[model samples]
Target: MTGIVTLTAAGAIDATYRVGALRRGTFTRAERYTREVSGKGVNVSAALAAGGADTAAVVVLGADDVRFARGGLTAPLLRIVEVPGSTRVNTSIIDAEGATTKVNAPTPPLSPEAWDATLSALRDELGTRPQPWLVISGSLPELAGTGTPVDLAAVRAAAREHGARVAVDTSGGALDALLADPTGIDLLTPNAEELSAAVGRPLRTLGDVVTAAREIVARGVTTVLASLGADGLVVVTADRAVFARAQAPSVANTAGAGDAALAGFLLGLTRGPAATAAGADPLAVAAASAAEWGAHAVAHASTIVAGPPHGIRALVETSPDLDRVLTAEGEA
Candidate 1:
């Protein structure tokens, strides 16, 4: 799979505000202001492209918001579908302590005609293009009379029809919908909290995480890659289960770490014959790759702002970190 496609929401500007402290009726200075295109799918696609993958991003942008949508893209191929209104804008405020508060604007409703047009464009591209990897991520904007549901099953089916492997990173109702029918999903990458929410249980230990992940695979998922934050990652498949532990690093911003991790994992999936042979059981490799990328992302965040930096080397040096945690908790 040389080419990859990412599908999700596309918005214009990301207005980021930084405040030193929060208090009622107090004037605070703005630390930084910048505009950028941001979304989970978009970020992941950009990371993959930056990492040297033949990648494209498919997004819905209002006719008026085309410029905004295209502004933040650096990918070689970016396909946009013009809809009725301007794309959404998301605002985030980061406090000095690295806590973030975000507000997202509502997206214009997509008419039946608009949906058809967008789907048609995607189908044509996938059918005619050489992309072999498809990433369906992020949340859909609410539109009038539209429940904001993304047709994951249809997306998966389409990717498979075009001989592409699919990876999904989403949550809430959309996550529930995909888990309802996990067929055709080559990889399900979820963070620990998301995984616990999806499985309807609290996963406090590595064994618990492994058990839950295996249950997810039993539901027709080929593989389950669970990101355990500072604890590293837990990968589960029908054949084997492996855990990779990275020492807790000072995380600058946990925001894009998951997306970066996904990028790393996908990159590993397409690496070479060994990765291909590992097939769905490439959890360890994926985890290792994701850890490195995520560490980089965290490190990058630290230099620009006052926050925790993800220690890439520390994570790699700590082997069996998860095992140690499990053993200390008497769950190993």
Candidate 2:
């Protein structure tokens, strides 16, 4: 793939509030507030575009907000799919310690017809670029008439037709569906908890995580990038696994670190090949870049990369310590 094209099945207007330590059941006033048109795919696309990568996002927007979506997120990077409903507003409360408390609204339902239209739009966008990575992020809303989850297979089919590799970032039943039939998906990004649930086991140590990711690789997925908040990232392929991490200078917000990491990894892929640490394996290079970008994301208050990326270094291990115990704080 030469560039990236993201599809956000569920999009939102993210409202973030900065406040002191939250007092439960009391009126906690916010010290600052910021709003942005966001979704997991939108966040990825934003970060990639900021890094000067060719990227576009196909977002499902409520008809009421479609008119204003371009004003917030640039029109060039976004392809809007309007459906009948009001856009959901997701709220985030960041405490003084940089801890985030998020309240995500219920996903707006989409009819099968609307979903078909959305997929058609995504396919059309993919055609615009010769070869692009199709990144599907965010939760999949159910069909209004059927009450069944959105069909991810259709998305894979669309990607296959355009010769695009698919990368998925989602959980719950959606994750189950992806795992049940890992046909066209090339990359899967899951946090520690999601990986544990995928293998139906508890991942107490790095070894457990690696072992679990291998199972996914065996199933058909080309690579699994597991996010371990503080512990950094673990990338597992069929033959090898590598771990990468970087210390964050500060933690201002962690809402979109994973998305930023994904963007960084994809950017590395778009730049031909990278050979920094542990030889010139694309996976290692991408993992190291992912760690560095994720660390930088937490240092900013916005959900997406804001400006010029500062210099940051990452430690990549070709042979990671499998027995290392995972800490409670490493949850992502």
Candidate 3:
């Protein structure tokens, strides 16, 4: 993969409001508000672009909001496909305490023609220069009046035919559909809750997280990276496992922290090949990057901004010893 290309089918107008406090039973006036076009993949692209990486996004934009999406994102390349429906709006309310209350709108359905067009564009890119890590993220839109065949597998198959590696970050039925094939994905990133939901149980501890993630690996996933809020992350592959944690940074708002982590994880992959003597388990290195990036996102006011505003190296040094952590699996 040359760089990253995200499929942000579920694009949205993201709005964030800042207020002194949010009391459930009263009217709370906003002190400030910021709005932009975002989706999970869009957020990843923004953060990657912030880190000075070349990125691209393929999104379904409302015909009217094309300029807004293009202008707000950090990506230099955008393959825009127009659909008839208005883009959904997602709202996040951040309080002085850094707690966030989010309101996510339903995904807009894609016309059969629009979906087909999107696939065609993706194919063209996969066949062209700058082979990229094709990321299929966000929720699946319901099929609208467009009687597009629900052939999601065909999309992945087409990518593989063109020799592209895929990464996934999605939940609910869409996630289940992906997990069913398991080994088809190059990487899978899930927060604890999403991991639990996928395995049909509640994960309450790190061990629980490991067990659930291991199950996904047994089903053929190449690797599982589960983000556990302040506790850090668990990165597991077919042959090894590592648990990594970093010192907690002060929280700003946790809205896009997971996306930030995924963005960092991919960045780490691009850093260099893992040097085992340097404690470089590929998964472990990726986990370290995830913690550092996640911490930085939580330390910022906006998800699109760069890490912690401090730097990534200091935080990564404080994280767990990846090779030592492998001892848990009796591999050290």
**Highest-lDDT candidate:** 2
Per-prediction CA RMSD (Å): 4.8, 2.0, 5.1
lDDT per model vs. reference: 0.67, 0.87, 0.74
List the pairs of residues colliding in candidate 1. 250-309, 252-308
Candidate 1 or 3, higher lDDT?
3
What value of lDDT does candidate 1 attain over all alpha carbons?
A: 0.67
| Rank order (by lDDT, best first) | 2, 3, 1
Query: Which scores better on lDDT, 1 or 2?
Result: 2
Instruction: Give per-model TM-scores.
Output: 0.83, 0.95, 0.87
Candidate 2 clash pair list: none
Candidate ranking under TM-score, highest first, comes to 2, 3, 1
C-alpha RMSD of candidate 2: 2.0
Which candidate comes out best when scored by TM-score? 2
Cα lDDT tens digits for candidate 2, 149-201: 88887888889899999999999998998899897789999999999999998
Quote the positional error of residue 28 for candidate 2 in Å: 1.4
